[model samples]
Target chain A: MLIPMAKLQIAGRREELSAVLEGIYRLQGMQLVDVARDPALDVDAAGLNDANSLTQARLELLVARLDALLALVGSDDRGDSRLHGDPDPVSGAVDLADVEAELDRISILVQEAAQHLDSLTDELAVLPRYLHPLEQLARLVPELAALPEYELQKLGLDTAALVLNTSDDTLVDTLRRELTEVFGVRFDLTSARVGTDAIGCLLVFSHSDSARLHALLGQEHVRHLPLPSAYSGQSLFGALAGMRTRLDALPRELADAHQVLEELIGPHVEAWHVTLAGARAELEQLAAAAGAGVTDRAFAVVGWVPRPHVARFHEALAALSMGPLAIEELPHDERAHSTPVLMKERRVARPFGLLTRFLDNPRAASLDPTGLMALFLPLMFGVMVGDVVYGTALLLVGLWARRKFGRISPGIADLCSVLVFGAIWAIIFGFLFGEALGNLGKNLFGDFSLWFYRGDANALQPLLLFALAIGAAHVLLGVVLGMWQSWRDRAHRHLLDRVGTFAFLCGMLGLAGFAAGALPPGFMSPAIALTVVGLVLVMSLHGTLGLIMAPLELLGAIGNILSYLRLAAVGLASVYLAIVANELATVGPLWLGIIVATFFHVLNLALAGFSPMIQALRLHYVEFFSKFFIGGGQAFIPFGKSHS
Target chain B: MDIGIGLIAIGAALAVGISALATGLAQARIGAAAMGAIAEKPELAGRAILLVAIPETLVILGFAVAAMAILLLPA
Candidate 1:
């Protein structure tokens, strides 16, 4: 719900201005509006001296550098963990010059340690690429050179080692075939898995065919590594020996670098975070003075404070009393457009609040759509998916994600909560639709339709009507709400507009009922009369332009109702995809069938999870929201709040 | 009868396919402009998605038509 706000106008001695502003900052409730904007207040706007300007620049520079430095280390609230039952040593305002000196000192050490850690990690990751292929070469190269009895080199047969860095078995096979074409069956090529991706190959071919072999390798663009030169002029065996030695030593270097970082940063990270936060808070408090109107003897600050916080605001000022100060609750200026919005929502509605905010903040005077959205969004999503297996899987996944990421990001937690609710609704709708993994329930239990099967073609007429009914209900509710808001705001034109839409929808539904022979013949005249009256009212409101506008508005409303057909369309799509999955499963061998079925079901499930969500959201954003939602209210940003 | 069934199938396919094509075309233009707007002001991301989603009603209406042709027509 949108919280009621009071416009607070504070006036005080110029000497007590800082104390009053600091007191308000501690309250953490009021969103300051610049008092200087009022031209009647003969006062300076910024009231910045050279000293304040210098302080602003210095604080900003320090805070920015600290932010970058802390972000690089991926630090988050580290100080709190270390301060268990202990007083915060870095509490209160920090001296800027001392912080600047300490920050610069720690910055150099952190940079060096971080650089060392990065290089060591890169070396560790790259070493395995070379190590695997070289091991294969070590086994082949020594045997060829040391076989004194064979004299293979004298016989014009030579061995050269190359490491191929490819994971494609087909490419390796192609290279083998090409080599055979060049050197015939006389050439021996032995290749082994060198690393996760690289291959180590030893080619033994006649010197006569060596040129063609090189050409073949070049033509294939075989991206092979030349023999490792751990030590130059070393034999292949000796080069592998040097690499083996370095591989053994690499881990030790990596460990040493890690230890260096731990030693450099372990004691200081928490302190640095605390100091950075304190400095930033102080900077915000100082900068908030720019919003005040300063005269020769007094100053003034005006802002909106939530109604519940008015008492707290009074208490904060009572504690900071130095001289005679006045804080008055100004009568709400209906004409003044500076009222910032603060929404207070229940925990159950918080996730929907996030979604509502995603579009834009609802006007303070307008309704908070969180409650309605919470009721409808997930329920509509469920109707689209409506599968027991998919619902259960999504529920489990959503629960796991919420547990895993809830503390780190509230936005992700809100999304997970939405998914969890949608999944629950999906489960309920699944049973109503009599679907469990498409028709798998029927196949297993021999006809499982508690209600009508959505996949059946015969359900199409009733399904479309059911969807249309839901659309009509939702649109009617929006019209009712719009009418209520119009009446509350005393917007007579808007009230008439919504009343016309309501009458038109009722008349249209009555006509549909009458045509289907569900209503008496006498009802036809009333329905036609209502529709014409609605049209006349709608048209009369627009005067001369109503001729064009009335028909357009009527068509737009009908189109909105038609849009709900997507609920049926999306549901049917999911059911058919699952049916296809089941059909494909029966086509192959048992193992292949299971694989194919699982693949298709997973694809269907993935689409069901994301596609239905988008369609459902589109229904809200495009169809429902267009009826009444007017979002452009400014979010309340309290003085001294950390936007970061 | 076979030729009639084939024609019905083609019509149903066209109902969905043509509208989907139109939706894709509309979304492509909207999405490109939305991306440019988002690049300039990241806060417009949510509104951009809504704009991109609006044209999908074309495909939805087409789907409804296709569903009618396939199911009601045969009956």
Candidate 2:
């Protein structure tokens, strides 16, 4: 699926070069190849015409603005942009005197507003305490002290009583005398114990004088204990708590003010856009003036375009009269060729339309093995997972997650799909083989022992044979797929190599069957003959040395076949784990056993699911990919707006 | 039955542990280098992550091996 590419060198006049580069930039889907600049070329001058540079600069500015907006929104940061935007030429060149005057005015206004706001905030903090009734009572202390000659008359206690610590008795006595003369009723000071604390003095008042005392206390200028509930021991602490509550509500109150500020600042932000447009217009004018003579300049401009966009690029160049610009096709070079097959097919098919355009023009290699990988990966996974119950559980979990999450990567989605398939296969194989919970054929399916050999003693040979057969099939499929791809590409040499590989595989299979008595004694003759043919083709396609060692290649092919036995081996291991879990669950007392069963089953399910998933992917990426894949293709990257 | 099961479990665990350790060390070393490159040019983060993940296949292979051992345990 990796597109084959060839490097090209382009030469043209400066103006013509710029036009061609611009046309390339306008192409919808193209990957630009990074070519080293010639030392002789003036890079700075050439870069001015370089469309990629302009695009990169534009993208950086856009990304910076987005980042600023995100920061304003208080979103998490995605790091900083490395590309610096051009300075605003007009602003940059402005006289220092003008800038200084403007700055001074703005600074003075900001400082004054900040100070006023701070003072207002501080005053609001103490407003609540001043409003309290107890504070009102304290204000009356001084007024009462001014009066002289008072006598005790009342003993009843009500709201008129003003209590004070004996520590400040002089102020209390003076206040009592002043209150008595004002109200025409004696204000008596009585000492009484309240709770465990000493009550220094309580001013008793008649019901009629109570109203007057309350009125005197309500006056402003009192520094009294705030409401008992509001007293926080220290004035600063109470003030701070009140200030914090008010400040917390400030944002809501100033929402409209903030909106106005944004409105005022919005024009300044838009000015950047105006500046960019002006710069672009100026560049266009410069280009127009240069005319046909622009091509005669000393520098060369180069750019990349996608293969599909080549026609459009050519049309644009023709319209601009920018001919004589050389164009080269970039080849796809991948380390593993099969990995991109699905992505490539998806690209060509366009099944999802614009939604998948990003995949087609990815900036990174879309190396995802899908087709042959689809089959072997699941089989390997099922074998490793082994238990039907655990596999089923994993499948259900994957299905639920996929449905809930909505969007997920195709690789992971495909993996889940494969695991589900594997689970189905495991159920059939597990039941037939009497491997339920690793008890073999004893207790499970009591009377149905015909489907599989009972216990480890009877199962070994049959399982080994099954493993060998599966390995043969897997390897054969890989070779066949390789051959088909080569034939499709019309690469005769690659086709011959694939054929050689197939024949070698067949010969090995025949020999193995013969050794196991699955074939006649004379089977070695066909195997040897086919193997010789395979070797000759391999040598002709590769080298003379390859042909000489064709027999050894056959032996190597046999070794690879043995590798598939691991599939069966892993399946057996999974069954063993399930058995162990079951045994552990049953070892404890009844109540404990229930708990253990739940815990062990969950643990086993997790292990079973993860182990198979990883192993299955490994078999495909390593064993299968090793045979015929090269997957280091540079992904297609188009020149356009990038989402940060 | 107990001895056989114990031996199999021990062997499988050991293999899994060794494989995991080897993979962990390999990934750590490769990942550090990839991270350094990404630090220099953050645009390359995606590519660097892909490269770093390549070495992680060893751990996967080890996991597969352990799974194989477990499957082959006498039952």
Candidate 3:
């Protein structure tokens, strides 16, 4: 059910506006309506967005900065938000400077550490490529070991490790020959094959002779192998030894860096979120203040409050002693927007409210379909997936999931709750339909059905008829609801249209029954009479347009009813698949058959979960909802709710 | 099977097969656009599934027609 709303005006002196707004914020009862556009306001309204621009800008900037800081900090390590206190927007503005100080501190420390950790990770990954070739070169050439012996720079010698790409086997020798030509025995080279297409060499030379040594190495088919950024500009033996030491220490350093980040960030994450939410809430309150109406002496905050909570809403704000304060209910201006709907339902129906809102919230003063959805969606799902074994499994899983993860995610909890209801219905229908892993019920206990076997070929016509009957009843219910809605809204033509549709559907079914010999011949005249009367009522309402669209709609409505055949078809598919699984089990070796049967049954169950649920929902959304639902209504968002 | 029965079987098979093909085509188009729309606005997900499922009614009707043909025609 949709709760009624009272359009309210809370007016007080300018000085009392902040305190009064704070009171309203704490109440979290009113959805603010902009005073300027509200025709319901008797006074000449003034916009407040321009009022106190500086403070609003400051708060907005604070929120942005806090959001940035929070982003830099990861989600709370504990994965629970309960550890944090709620934001208190009305407390004071003294913490802005403290927040700024914290932001600056986090920014500098995090920037340096983040850059360091990033480079370390990249270098760690890149370092292995260098090691493979260097190791290969060292394994092939034993003389290379002597190069690491030097504290090369202290000894005034430098080593450049090179991996040269070349098809020629003599490329290393040519490089050695070329280097000797350039420096004339000032350099010693130890070269070996790196891989099939390359040579790896350690060239030890005078540090002073490095410029000329590189000029020859830069020649085609021969270039110095690039080193990681950290190890650049160092001797190969020194870089290698440094890299080896770094390699050993890298994991520990990476862990230390992460640990440092966690220590700096983890504890304050929830606090930051709370602060961020508080700053945003304050900003929203300020914006609401800006939107509020003002005179030379009085400030008026116009909003909608739930009718049942109107007294409590006033009592929540009674603490504020604003001079000559008055709170009054204003008449709703039907055309001017700002009335939002809040759905009120029982605790059991609360979970299904999610599905209702997933499409759109019910329009203000319109019917809430949550109760209908809760009643029908699961029942239809049960009808489609009637199986005791599958239903039991789903029941256990749904219950476990609802209990375990419901606290973590409300959406998942809602889905799990819905699944539990659906599973219960499935079990009830399973016994009624006589299904347990398909025909296994029959094999176990001959004709164990409380009703009839759904798997029998003889059941197809009856199942189709049953499904159509369900569809017709559901469609008729939707039409009736639509008629009531139109009547309440005083949409006279829409009411008549729904009435005509309802009468026509009822009459058409009667005629269909007569044609199929389910009704006596004497019933034909009245059935035809009722249908003609309905068609005339429908046609008279639309004038020129009704002639074509009315009859087409008749076909469409018939098609809509026929659409429920999927319930039978899909159910039959599931049952036959199970039967095949059982048959395959009996035909093969016992162990192999058991395995195959288990595999197929599991596959069938998986398909059942998605297929039947989707089909049942489609029957409602398309066939049923089309008859009544008017979507695109604005959801009620209270002033104090997190703007995020 | 008699020739008349074979032809009736072929007609029934066509009734189901052709509509299934049409439904596949319609759903393919609907599903692709639905996925794209859902990627941009995830709140459209339920409606997207609804749109994707809407076309499958064609195949279901076809199944019904085939069932009628097999169960009622010869009788």
Which scores better on DockQ, 1 or 2?
1
| DockQ score of the complex predicted as candidate 3 | 0.60
Q: Give the TM-score of candidate 3.
A: 0.84
Better of 1 and 2 by TM-score: 1
lDDT of 2: 0.51
lDDT of 3 at A374: 91
Query: How does residue A597 of candidate 2 score in lDDT?
Result: 62
lDDT of 1 by residue, A275-316 (tens): 776777667767768768777888888888888889887787
Residue A387, model 1, lDDT? 86
Native contacts kept, each candidate: 0.66, 0.00, 0.62
Give candidate 1 regions above 4 Å deviation: A38-46, A68-90, A101-267, A316-324, A334-337, B2-6
Q: Put down candidate 2 lDDT per residue, A11-73, tens digits, no spaces.
A: 566545544544444343333333333232233433234664554455445445433433332
Which one wins by DockQ: 1 or 3? Answer: 3
Question: TM-scores for chain B, in order?
Answer: 0.92, 0.80, 0.92
Distance from true location, Cα of A36 in model 2, Å: 10
Ranking of all predicted structures according to TM-score, beginning with the best and ending with the worst: 3, 1, 2
lDDT of 2 at A521: 82
